[model samples]
Structures are given as structure tokens and as C-alpha cells.
Target: MDHMGADPDPDGRTAREQLKSERERDARRRRARRRFSVVGAVVVVAAVIGTVFALGGAAEDEAEGRPLVVPANTVGEQRTSVLYGKADARHTLSVVVDPRCAPCARMEAALGRAMRQLADKGAYRIEYRLATVEDDARGGKGSRWAVNALGAAANEGPEKFVRYLDAVLAGRSGREEWDGDALASPETLLGIAGRVDGLRTPAFDKAVRELTYLPWAKKVAAAHNQNGDEDALPAVTLDGSTVTVLGDDGVPVSPGEFIRQVRGDKG
Candidate 1:
């Protein structure tokens, strides 16, 4: 009794319904994505604003009265490990990173680029330290790799450490490893470490195994996370007083703005 002219086939109704369902599902995903983007943007803006206020010293909303950031100066602390810039530069960037956290890799890239740009202009130098956070739920193997590799690099020179670190952040040995074969084993890590100049020696391999510098590692971790010191990774302190930027929330504050504000650059 079906009207032949109204329908081409009996399955046409089912096919139309399926297509409608798929369309609705896709539309929901798009809406979800848009909402997330908007929320993320707002959070970043708020964090940047907070940074500007904190660094700029706008006393209008000074609730905590501008907290001070204490400098880390332990006997075991090396000059190169204090900040993330070239040697002999005034300013320092001590970055706390967890190898398992993907964002740490991104921040490392950004920080490296920032240092190169500054160095080219004779503006500033950054000292680097690869420290681990206690809250890092992962086995901290990546932190260990960084500490060991950096220690190896430090033995050779800061430049070599920087080069090796650049490789580590860029997935040179595969960033995502569940079994930890890429960085957990001394042989595998030492192989990569040997490629860096100054560290390709039997003595270098032995020093890495000895890990004489691990106490320094613990001190660096404590410096940033001390009681009431709430600064997080990707966070930059200017002149040991101002919190210029926080990378924890993915804000995109320009480096120029940061330098001008933190270094008191009039230009």
C-alpha cells in the first residue's frame, strides 16, 4: 500500500535518520570545541593580567602586598644552573620541568628561542636548571634523564648541555615512552649524552653513574616550591621580585613585554 512515487526505497528512511544523527554528533563536537577555546582564552588573559599587575607593581589591588621571590644561592648551586640564559648574563631563568608533562617541552622550546633572541641583541643571558617537582606523579624518570644529561653537559660546558637539552625536548629519543627504555637506562641516555661535546669520555660516563650532583638537584627543586612559594613551571621571576609570567595556564605574553617590564627597559 506504500506510495511508489513518495519513496525511492524502503531503506531511504533509515539512511536519512542515520545521516541526521551523524550531523547532530558533529555539531555537538564543534560546539564543545568552541566553548573550550573561549574558556582557555579567558583563563590565559586573566593570568597575563595578573602577571602585569604583579610585575608592574600596580598597587590598586595589592591584596598580598607584592610577595618577594628569594634567590637560590646554595653552596652546591652552579652559576649555569641558576637561570636559562647564556653565561655571564645578569638575569636567570630557573625552569622546573617534568619530562612526562607535554607542556614542559613546549616551554623549553620557547625559552630557548627567547634566549637566542636576547643573546643576539646583547640584551641578557639566561641560566638553566632542570629541576623536578615532588607532585609529579610519574616516576620522575624524565627528570632524572634531564638532571643526568644536564650534569653531563655541565661537566663539558653549558653550551653542550643546552644543545643536548634541546634534543631531549624535541623528542630526539621519542618523548612518549611507557617502559622508560629511552631515558631510564644509563647506557641509552649516555649514548645520547656522548654526542654532546666534552661529555664523550669514560670519565663522563662514570660521573653520570655516580650522580654526585643530585643534592644540587634537590636544592633547586626546593628553591621554587618552598613554603609559600607558589610559582609553577614556565613561571619567570624578574629581578628576584616580580612574577613576570606563568606558563602553567598557557598564556602567550610576548617576551619583549616581559623584558621591558621586568628589566625596566625604557625602549
Candidate 2:
């Protein structure tokens, strides 16, 4: 698989991470030269570097023989994705994201509400593809750990999972950038879970701590690597084609505009 975790940068960063960092620094330099002439350009560029779902124990977790705790109502051979919206909804909007990716956070901060409103209005369903590439890039396990926590939330049903997912992205953290150290902590995961109504149950907390869904999290990352030419994290795809949510000026098109664009672009 052509995963970002493949090639190592000299400083031990993964290729994607290195490239993303370089791009960001370069963008900053260019912005300074242009005297902040085009702030929108950076937003669009940052958005594309945003997603990943990659790793685990002994296959990383494969050799452990722990029972895979699949989320309820998810699809695919590995049961990847958190299924949301009406099954019969006329369209599917696939959103890829990662826990510690700063771009993913900004993407969420920018248009998450619009997407949810559309989903609620039956404009389209959403399949959240959570990635762990950030974990691999940084030699941290927070991405997989976060996904495992998500699995615990999903076990209770989509509503819990959805609320918990949003909370993890922003809930009580009350910040923009992700605190990777906090994400790596099971107690932090539990604390985020506590913000979701009825999600911080004993079983849910146990699963997050013990990583009952670790196997599935790995599967999701593997499948992510094997499947598509990754369009980037925090990406949006409709009818199997990538869609740009923000305009050239870096502003999100209104929810109405988004729907019209998707409808026009449907393959």
C-alpha cells in the first residue's frame, strides 16, 4: 500500500507529514511576501493536507486475537465508517478525517455545521472515514486510540457516535488545534465521552481504555490505504468524486450553494 507511513523523512517524519509541513511553512513565507494578499489560498491548501486513518499491535493488533468490536450499522468487509443519515437518502457525502490533523480540525471548524444541516435535511448521508495516519507520522497512537473511542460510541448507536464524534473534534476541548498528548490519554477520551449525553457509560469507558476496537481501527487504516488514491483528509466526496467546499476566495459556499454544487456534480 502507498501509505504516508511508507517513506521516512530524515527527521523521522512521514513523507506526507514532511511535505505538509514544508507546504505550510512555504505558505507562511509566501503569505508574508504577499503581505497576506491571499489568505484564502492557504485555507484551500491546508484543507487538502487534512485526512488519514492508518496502524496497531502484531499486525499491529491482529496477533492479539482480541475480538473485533465493529461499530453497529457500518458497511464494508472490515465494517469501516460510521454510518449516518437515512439509508435511503438520495446521495452519500463521504468525509475523511483524522484526530490530530490540524487541517482536519480547521475543515471541521469551517463547514461541519453546514454539512450536518444538509444531512439533517436529507440532502445526503455521510460516511465518516476516520484515519490514523497522524499517529503513524508522529509515532503516536492517538489516532487509533480516538477511533477506538469512536467505536465505543458507535456501539450505543449512531446518535451517540455522531454526538461523540463532534465532541471529540471540539466538544469540551474548547480549542482549535488538537492536543495530541490529551488524545493519547484514555482518561482524556473518557472526558470527551462524558460531554456526549449518555455516552460515558461503564462499558464505553472500558472499551476505550482496553481498546476493544483496536483491530477494527487498523482495518480502517489498511482499507483506507488500499482503496482510493487518497484525495486528502477532511475531504468531501459525492458520487465518488471529490468536491471542493470552499470557494476560490477561501470562503465556504453557503449550505444552499453546496447542495446545488453537489447536485450539479453528481455522477
Candidate 3:
């Protein structure tokens, strides 16, 4: 009856075996695909994490590298009084100064170098408190603008601010007509600031041109007058005590003596 060709495996064992092999092959392919997907996802996540960390590190580095200009004791809550030198210094020399005042200029010319030396030696730290008494008294905005400019330069860094202040002081003779007119225009102030290294940044220039710090300057002056004698400019204080340049003999101390007195080396 040709049974050999009709029913080679009565239970269909060959077909069953082929079906089982196909199922095994399919299972292996699915496992390989799942492993590949998991590995790819892990790699993608690692790459994204690595890129974020690299960018975050670069941003931190940029922030740390840029110089900071601090405006202390102004209208804001983050006010700082450190114009120069270390904030945690043992001795503090707080000087209330007017940019347009002749006496302030003379005081700076005499003691500027010495004060810087003292600060460098870590003997004392200097805090320059800005005041616009001259402008208020003169009925003009010159002192305010000048102070604003100085404050703007301060944004560059304390050293640049000091340099800008020095440049302004150098051109003054204490007379209102000369000092006021010389610094009346933004161009004049910008010109002076341009000479100082790192002081002529776009932000600084914008502040000077737009009078961005005028409000802060006004607040500083108001605060100064409220705290101390309004008429006095270039007032020096050593360790919270007022230091008069004039000695017991009513004679002004020399620049060297001034440094010595500030350093507690009067002997």
C-alpha cells in the first residue's frame, strides 16, 4: 500500500523537530536584539552624562577665571565694604573719599603708595567708602557721575578700580571748576578709565555711558553722610577709630608717618 512514502513518521516527528529548531532560533535572535538595545541605551546615557559634566566643568572654570568687582555696603543685600585687600584682615582702614575733593586727592597722592604697601604686607586692609559731598554741595552731578564711573570700574576688579581712582585723583586739583568740568562728560571719564589695564570692558563702558551705578553712588553718598560728618571728605579711620592726619602738635603727618600710624608702628 506504499506506506513508506505515505507516512514516513506517523506522529510527524520531522515537522515537530523543524518547528522546535525554528522556535529556538527565534528565541536566540530576540535575546541578541534585547542585549544590543540595552547596550546601546547604556552607551547613549553615558555619552549624555559625560557631555553634561564636561560643559558644567567649563562653565565653572569660566566663572572662577573672571575677575569680580565688588560694591560693598550699597543698596543691595550683598553689600561689601572691601574696596581692596583681604576682607578678613585683622586691621581695617576705612577711608571715606570724594573723587572731586582736592583734599582727598592730596591724601591719596601722599598715602596711596604707602597704603597699598601696607595692604600688600597684610598689615592692614583698606575699605574705600564713596561719597559725593562735593557734587551735592556744588549743585552738580559731576561727583555723582565720577563716583558712578569708579563704581563701574570696580566691577572689573578691586585693582582696576584702584587704578581708575588713582587716574581720576591725579587729574584733580580740588577746585570744583577744574575737577567738575574735567569729569563732567562720560568721554573724559572713559578716556581716563581706558588707560587702566582691564578697566575698559564693555560692561564698564556701558555703565559709565548709561549711568548705571548712579543710584548706587547716591545710596553710598547718602549712607556715608548719615553715618559720619557730611562736611568731611577723605576721613580716615583705623580699626574703627577715626585717625586724624594732624598729630597732637596740629601738624599733618608725612606720608611715611601716616603709613606708620596706620600700621601701629608710630614708635
lDDT of each: 0.53, 0.75, 0.71
Name the top TM-score candidate.
2
Which digits, one per residue and each the tens of the lDDT, describe model 3 over residues 117-178?
77877877788887788876776566877887888877778788788888888776443235
Model 1, CA-based lDDT: 0.53
Which candidate model has the greater lDDT, 1 or 3? 3
Q: Which pairs clash in model 1?
A: 83-93, 83-127, 83-128, 84-126, 84-127, 85-126, 85-127, 86-126
Which has the better TM-score: candidate 1, or candidate 3?
3
Best-to-worst lDDT order: 2, 3, 1
lDDT of 3 at 116: 78
Residue 197's lDDT within candidate 2 is 84
Q: Largest lDDT belongs to which candidate?
A: 2
lDDT over C-alpha atoms for residue 100 of model 3: 82
Q: Write the per-residue lDDT of candidate 2 for residues 1-267, one digit (tens) a residue.
A: 557555555577777788799999999998797866566678766665342222233333442478766878686566798888887888889988887766566566667777777788898888888888877777777888888888888888888887787777773224745654458667888987888888878899888877888888888888888886463556779968878876665455566777677878863
lDDT winner between 2 and 3, please give it: 2
Q: All predictions: root-mean-square deviation over Cα?
A: 17.0, 21.6, 21.6
Candidate 3 TM-score, true structure as reference: 0.65
